[model samples]
Target chain A: MIVAANPIGQAITWINDPLNWTNPGGMLDRLGEHLTISALAVALGCLVAWPLGLWLGHLGRGGGLVVLISNATLAIPTLALLTILPVVFASGFGKTPVVVALAVFAVPPLLANAYTGVRQADPEARDAARGMGLSSAQLLRRVELPLAVPYLAAGFRTAAVQVIATAALASFVNGGGLGQIIRTGFGIGIAAGGGQIVAGGVLVAGLALLAEVVLGGVERLVTPKPLRRGRQRLGRPRAADATGSA
Target chain B: MSFRLSYLADPGNPWFSWQYVRDNSDTILAAVREHASLTGRAVVIAVLIALPLSVLAYWFRPLAGPILAVSGVVYTIPSLALFAFIAPYLGTGATTVLVGLVLYALLLIVRNVVAGLNQVPPEVREAAEGMGYGRWRRLFRIDLPLALPGIVTGVRLATVSTVALVTVGVLVGHGGLGQLIFAGFQNNLYKAEIMTAALLCVALAVVLDLLLILVARLVTPWSPRRAR
Candidate 1:
């Protein structure tokens, strides 16, 4: 059989080759690494960002500061952070720098969303809760948190997908991820590794898309049942909202 | 510890050194210029393409779903993957990077365009129609004016994100500040180079974002600052 000449065909061939998946540092290993790093970063981001955003949002005092901080962080280039953190912090190149950078990268959407979600909870419900003698904590837990679930979910999905995508940059710092495949392909020169590069791209893109779809479903599932029914009404504008920010 | 010239000249590995910045000012400036130009051009082209497409989507509701979906899918593609995918075909250069950045910018711009058009009050459009304004004229004169804030918001978002994403284009050899960052990393982890480039990239994003905000305010003098 003749080797396929075009990169696309070669990419297909590359994916078909079992050796590519099974070898050490191959697709499977890289895929695992990618998932692990992304998960870790997102988890870290959520842990730090969500509570701060939620508490501040609930108080309604620090929205300005929160937005300001998040926006400022957003401007810092991910690649720059990824490269510089390891050296400046003396952390050495690897997953540490990658995860820290990605976690920082993930924070803006999560924090902003969590804050917005809780802040936008129904005013009537909050008043009723307050009148009913429910404490602020109780109100947050029973009323606002539930109301904020959708926004929180949206933010989570955004952060997760973004972390997964940016995690590929880890390859630049000798960190593990599926980006290794693409980097390796480039290292081999386009003639020979063109297929490899394309395959790597397809894999990363596929993974990100898969995450998006899965998270989208999770978003729908986690939404309150009532909101689910009214979602058609609420969902349309929110779709535009999500797209604009995320 | 006494501050010493030796530390600046330290061959070991200094986190930052003004001397490096001074020596590489030309290279740094070039990277900054390239970064700014690539981001600016990509966003401009994206706005150009997204404007017409968004109008079609807004005009025909059915098109909005598919348009947003396609652009959403494109947006979801990781920058590295997108660039790598294009590089094989575009052969790794500014064009490939530009195409990828433009595609990334498309969804943000398109969504905002649709959202902006959505913001055009039905009554206003009707009033214009009642005044015998043609559909095109009403759209341009009435709907678009109302939509300006939203459209500008999208453009602002796209520009800032593009500034950051353009650094990823270094994979294809076109990342403006990204080259310096990558070079710093690859060249024995030169902190000054990486820091300088990174800080400059951030500054560019902030400057451009402010410029857009100023433009938005100038265009929509009627509306106070709308939180993006």
Candidate 2:
């Protein structure tokens, strides 16, 4: 039987072909690579940003500057960052450059959210904790941190989703990921590779949406019980507040 | 750093070269123009589309959640994936990038529009109505004026982000400064070219942001926040 000629048909045929998924540097390998890069970048970002953000928030110092800097960072295009890192590092096409770029992209949401979350914690709770003779560190560990869980979770969700989506660009630098499928398809020429290209796009988009949904659940789950009821009143976390996440 | 054109061809491949800038001034200007135009057009169109939809959502409270949700989902999609998905249908070029950029701008614009509209005091609207102002007139003269600050803020955010995202259009061969950045990366990692393009992008964002802030101030001279 003749393979269907439409792009969607070709994409379906491409996905249906078990050989496509099982082959080396195929969909599964790309998927694994994508996840690894995303995970590493997000972890690194959190390590650097969380402590700084949380400390600043607790101190109520540099909050305005943090917001300004965060906003400025958002204006840096993701593509430019991805391309420039490798040049600055003098590294050839590989995961390191991509990871660093993605990490930079991930920092704003995580840092801003963490800072805002803690700073916006209930003033009464802070007073009570202080009144009860809690130490500074104890106040942070027991009172502020717990209350900041939802914000932290929301920030994590945004970072993860943004990284997962941006990870597709790794292929442009030969960093290898699901983006490789799309890049490879382009190399093969659109006429023959339309299915492959479309398939790659589908996979990346689907994976990003999936991360968003899953992390959204995690964000909900991590909210303290009393806060859960007031979640709507608190307002939805504005993920768009991040620059390149768009 | 030398002004000599030969420095552009120097074997050392330095990351910064004034010679390169002199030689490529036209190309650089063209890229900047393209980047700025794409960003400006996308944001303008997004505001147009977002404003009416925002009004609808505000007037009909039931629609606000879904409107915001859809835009949020669109924003969540990776820029490359969206471009790739649309390329087949639209083919590659400015059109594809413009469409994608506009979609990305919608969430910021819509949210801001809604927020701006919400900031209008109920008493002002009531006062406008008491003066026999028509519904549309009240909205135009009362609601929108008060909402201008928030709307401008949204426009500022969308414009800056779009400036950055315009580089992704290079995926479809339309990424203004992104073209230079990509070309430099491909040409054995030409650091000067990449750095120049990237820096210009950041500079452009800053300039536009400042310009919008100026516009916002001029438009909302009466804002209490401004008085403070």
Candidate 3:
């Protein structure tokens, strides 16, 4: 294969390339495309998961079915999904297909989290919301949603990481991104050289790290400060209490 | 069904080519054999390293944060990217793949080990020490037993992640079940190849997880009964 050639020398050459650094647009454009695909997938996942999870959590039925399906879906390998999705959709290849495949992969975490978040919402809060002459819709929006933000955000973080990783798999189908560079380099037996492969790998890793940091920050910002403080205070005691009870 | 079979048997159809099957079979088998040996070795090495490292981390609380942070960063990198990054140094073939898998397994195993160690009630450890048990005796007899469940949980997670990450080895032409899936995609033989690989992966994960839970029970009799 391409890697059989002197990989170290090739990698060094790719890394030292003036064109990669000097023509920053190429790299940036690919990064932008990757981010766009990931973001869209995550957004679409949220739309599907939020409603379904809310319904299951509130109604307290079909949860087993939902969980079973989602868990099973989680096991459907990304490459398999990417391969099969195109056959069914006839889109052939591109960002749209990548987003669709990733969205499917992303949905389960959000759905699971949303269900858990809503189900685990303090019953007293729900009762209080009911006693306050609030409508069901109002109770859901004001009490359930606000309470579920942290869990939902946790799910979003999971989705974010999965999307970022799988987004690179899109390169296999000739869909453009850093994966394209990595796959092509490897395909041509140049990946062993370390330059294009390392560069591409670093770029992808950097993107994943950036996503985690940014989204984690957003999660913290959106989560209520009092709730955050409560979590800190409750964390140790709750664990101790749970262990004691057990 | 008979008509479909007849169509498949037709000489005019490309699907009837024995040449395609013959040429790919040797490559596929070799890839599977090599991938399995590499991954198996990697996991064994990782467990040995991680288990000791975890104990040391627990004993030296100050080291935990940095060690965990480094592992966590390693964990976040996609398997393909990680393999690619190491490929230059290790070069291709089994060694590079093994190194990448071991690194990937470390973060999960270490976290579980730490959690397992922490779960040993302080009083239990103190009582063991008070009984004149040396650190080694206490660790092996008391701590390790109690920690088994958590460690097992970590092992289960690592197993699934390892199975998935092993697929990335295909990118370097070190193939396994991923080769089957990839070939299925390449040949457009969707059901026969992709489904077989997918089922095998899921089966491997489930079976291994179940076996670990059994091992945990056998090891830790005092622990609460595991959830079904």
Candidate 4:
């Protein structure tokens, strides 16, 4: 009987409803809030994960340790991380605990991919750049970094998708996002709440897919010619990102 | 099973202490057990199916991209939504969670397995083939062992991520540590249960992942550590 309020149908209803288009609690506002949260958190995550991974990858030391560490990061539950962070750091950055939690969640894949991307760069090319009298910075910029661009973008793609999907959890902690609809809808009754939850799920999933498609496109644009034939190369960057669990 | 009278006597200490955890050992252990069984079963089942199919898929290069794309898209679905979507049909039980986990895992597991298979040194396969080793014999003796480190790496990633994802099952009442985390949050932020669950879940993930790595090392002694 309740299947009529099918998740897909419910999603369409929620999307079509004009009421949601208007106010503080409207779909647009929550979408904006969700995007802002994910954007800020991903930015913070890259700031930390990118430089550290870049340094580690460039030095060619601790490669095993870095991958091991990043791999292990996938094991800790994000919900647990989100909850534990607030209690552990009860003082600093009082207003945006969710951002901090999400940033932590977003770090592993970005770090893992950035390191692997740079570390995996063509060694011969790296040496050639060096032999040509390029400074350390120039070698990194002109050769290694460019080659690693696909991976860096891959990291961004994975991190962005994850942060956006997980950001829905913020509503549980009184933070703003589309999850608010799902949470409130559940309390109201299935026909309404259930439908809303379905719709909200669609929104989150849609956003994640959008991120994947967009980033995958960007990754393709930056990839060098020969590497394109080995589409399998895209697999490594993406594989680590998937290691970041729900 | 028993509460410490002295700890209870002090009403002023509002947060969780070691005593509180000691008192609730039975419930906590049960939840952990439930979580392990659900997640463990999903992984075991997935590897069994994925291993064979992926090996074939690797052999048949034409099918690789399409199959992987379908599975990858499945992974893109958010867990909660996937759970909800399936719940109505599956009737909201442990079975439903398994269905979701298995589907989510298929892509990650299958893709990694295929990737691992593909990475096996071509010469080793050629050598085995030249020896007139039967296909099955070659797969078991040469290709599999050589390809194992990669396969095991994929398994490690899949298992670890699966364990972490099991926590989301708290959305219903089935998730093991997830239930503790959810209950603690709902009950006025009972710090002890929340902290215990958090620490325990993390410990479980790290330990399981490390255990897999150690196993991988033991199995692939010939493979030197090289990653990019």
Candidate 5:
């Protein structure tokens, strides 16, 4: 039976552990590797999902099927996929498999959000673009895409969070990351108490919070100012109309 | 079942025999049943806890942001790690799994609850107040009804997430569809195990999705048919 040690104490002990301090660079390197894997997975997922989402949104056909498949993919549990993939491909233990698994997991939100965002773009604006002799590509690039940016960014935010969180699960299959610290902390000798466990939990939780803050910052930076200004303008007109009618 | 030439042709191969598949049917059925019951319990517990918490969070706007943030942080923890982390405190049982699932659902439910409450037109609230309805009466009789659609949507999303997350319960030796998945990995029966787990999970998700749609229709009879 495990003893219940104070988490704060354990965290202190973990921080003071000579081994962790000695190879602080190693820990940072591992964190970098984890980030690299997560970033690549998101990038690849965006590359594939963005086009599909755009096409699906534009056509408004095949959306049911696309949504079904994407939702199904989302429902596919990470651990289950991790367990199954390694068998089909023998090389599933390391970074490659982890990246692929994460990418698959990441695609659904990106696809769904992008599709919804594009479809939700102002129809009048789209029509105006077309009436101005803008090509389909130009319409998408300048009108629909820009308007859809916030929604797409929201999707990316979700994907980024999920990827960072699930990356820890990769350690179960010996895929290295901050998860290594977690697994090692848990797998230590039988007398192990709350300290190491809490420490590990803190590490993972810390990483998750870090990812959210960083991605949230990126989202704010990338979102166009004109969109916010337009929304504000729209809101004011609506409120005024409501007041006038009232 | 009738024996075929193909069966006889590969008599030496274990997989070629109908007996092999037949022999495993009972085990598979038992596993499936066990998984269903565990998942059902987890989801029920999650809804029960999340619904009230969501309502409370909605009522207290000052607390909404922090509550939602905390839940979001909880949501972002890897399911397995979360389960493992809590297993020690709660012990490895359905109770622990239930708590974890409930915590996960909080993020989605609280946001939806708040959104739904906020979506209630200020005029409606003012009209209710002007008509002398009390806070609880207005909330239940007017606000909640209007917010039903959004709340239902949130529940649907939470249902899907809860279903997916329950698979991690298997790691702590609790029975679920994850059992098939883990077994598949260990025994190298990839197709049998993975296919079963994937199909079951997807089917559960679809079923929940449809069930929630029906519930929404029933609850909000006058609601527009627009999809969010």
Candidate 6:
């Protein structure tokens, strides 16, 4: 029921306030907290997804299966999960529950990418590795791992962006983040010009875009040099296809 | 040490009692109906808008990059952030979440549809042209059928994800099962409310996904295997 009539103006005031910028729960702290949660979540996601993805990819047996299952998980609503999890973890309250949900959220992309990255490696090269007498472990570590870097990077970045966006829900669970401001501001209604909610929403959206741009840059850098050059030579159509879907 | 399984079977709990269902049937039915409408309307609207856009994207080679980039960016924005951002303009209630869900549905549907159309074999198009089929006729009769797998996949993905997202609508006061979930949270882990809410959400997702797959199969009888 609470919303400012002059929402945009309120946002400007909330975002610009020297006091709002300075306190423990200020914009800076919330942003930092959000980034921390995202980083930890993505890291944890990689831990859950990487090994199985890599194994299946190397074997060339179940990469698609793993990817399919993981992608299904990606469709699970984070807000729903965030609320549902706390009940399961009755003793758990805030960050831990948030982190667990987010970590699970991040897994699908990483799993999919890790699988495709390894499985899509040039078959001739893989055959050569086998012909050269590489053990399974050697084939995975020395051959497949390096080639999968780009896929790993893509997965990591995608999952990171997803986590960063979804992490805003953490505040609903009392987990400290930018969501608190929006929740409280909205709860209080049109008073204070509805600026706090507007400001919080802006900050979260801005953070999500920032993560995408930064990760996109990192993805470019991690891609194999030859493929990177090849991609540019092939130009925009090829590039668009690569990012056409998540 | 506390026993976890007992929580579900607690005799006093509404979750374990049919009486609770009878008592709350109207409220439960409304919430379920609300969630379904939110997801269904959003998906249908998204498909109508996105399907045309997808055809255009594939037709205009130059537009592909911009279209995909825009959708990808939109996809990353948190649903709540977008919901909150537009809430003031949309002015609360079901419309707010509907618009938000519609926006979220566009990227996936558009991408998959276009991808499906693009993957139609060149040889098939050549054959269609060789047979003197008109461009528009060939597209509808041939190309569209070939692309059915991917298009159906897009629909399936969007349907399931939208079902999951419907619960988040409660944050804006429009969610189906989410009302119960939020109540459970607010009521300090009311076991009956939280468990039932969670179970319903999970059930909705599974049921919707299976239903979509069945529909997809009936539509694309030729594509025996699942479209990857």
Cα-based lDDT at residue B153, candidate 3: 70
Candidate 6 segments exceeding 4 Å error: A1-4, A61-65, A130-133, A190-193, A229-246, B1-22, B127-135, B225-228
lDDT of 2 by residue, B120-208 (tens): 88898889989999978987888899899889878988888888889878777899999999898788778788889989999999999
- The digit string of per-residue lDDT tens for model 4 on A1-246 reads 333246566667777898875766888888888889989999999999988888788887777776676665666787776665655555322427889888887887788778888888888998888889999888777787887888888778888888887887776666778766666655565555556667777777787789878878887787777777755454345435655448
- Give the alpha carbon lDDT tens digit for every residue of A1-246 in model 3: 224355556666775776764464456667777788888998998999889988788776777766675546534556666766665565455467778888987777777778877887899999999999999888878999889888788778777876787788777655666676677656655434357777788888887778778877877787778777656321111111111100
Instruction: Please tell me which predicted candidate would have the highest DockQ against the true structure.
Output: 1
Give per-residue CA lDDT, model 5, range A111-221, as digits (tens). 777787788888999899999999988888888888888777767877777787777776666677776665665566313645555555666667776876787777767
* Worst lDDT 10-window in candidate 6 chain A: A233-242
Please estimate how well model 1 matches the true structure, expressed as its whole-model Cα lDDT. 0.83
Q: Looking at the true structure's interface, with contacts defined as alpha carbon pairs within 8 Å between chains A and B, what fraction does model 3 recover?
A: 0.31
Q: For residues B1-228, write the lDDT of model 1, one tens digit per residue.
A: 645333334566666789999999999999999999999999999999999999999899999999999998988888889877888877877998899889988888898889999988888888999999997998899988898988998898888888988888888788999999999888877778888888888899889988998888888889866576
In candidate 2 the C-alpha lDDT for residue B25 amounts to: 100
Note each model's CA RMSD in angstroms. Answer: 4.2, 4.2, 6.2, 5.4, 7.8, 4.3
If the candidates were sorted by their TM-score against the true structure, best first, what order would they fall in? 2, 1, 6, 3, 4, 5
State TM-scores per candidate: 0.91, 0.93, 0.84, 0.84, 0.80, 0.88
Q: What DockQ does candidate 3 score?
A: 0.30
Record all residue pairs in model 4 with backbone atoms less than 3 Å apart, i.e. clashing. A185-A193
lDDT of 1 by residue, A134-173 (tens): 9999998899998898988988988888888888888988
Candidate 1 regions off by >4 Å? A1-5, A229-246, B1-12, B221-228
Q: Whose TM-score is higher: candidate 2's or candidate 5's?
A: 2
Select the stronger candidate by lDDT from 1 and 4.
1
Error of 3 at B116 (Å): 1.3
Query: Taking the candidates in order, what DockQ does each have?
Result: 0.47, 0.42, 0.30, 0.33, 0.26, 0.36
State residue A100's C-alpha deviation in candidate 4, in Å: 1.1
lDDT by residue for model 3 (B109-225), tens:
888889999999999999999999999999999898888877887676666556655666777766577777777767644445565565565665566667777877887787677
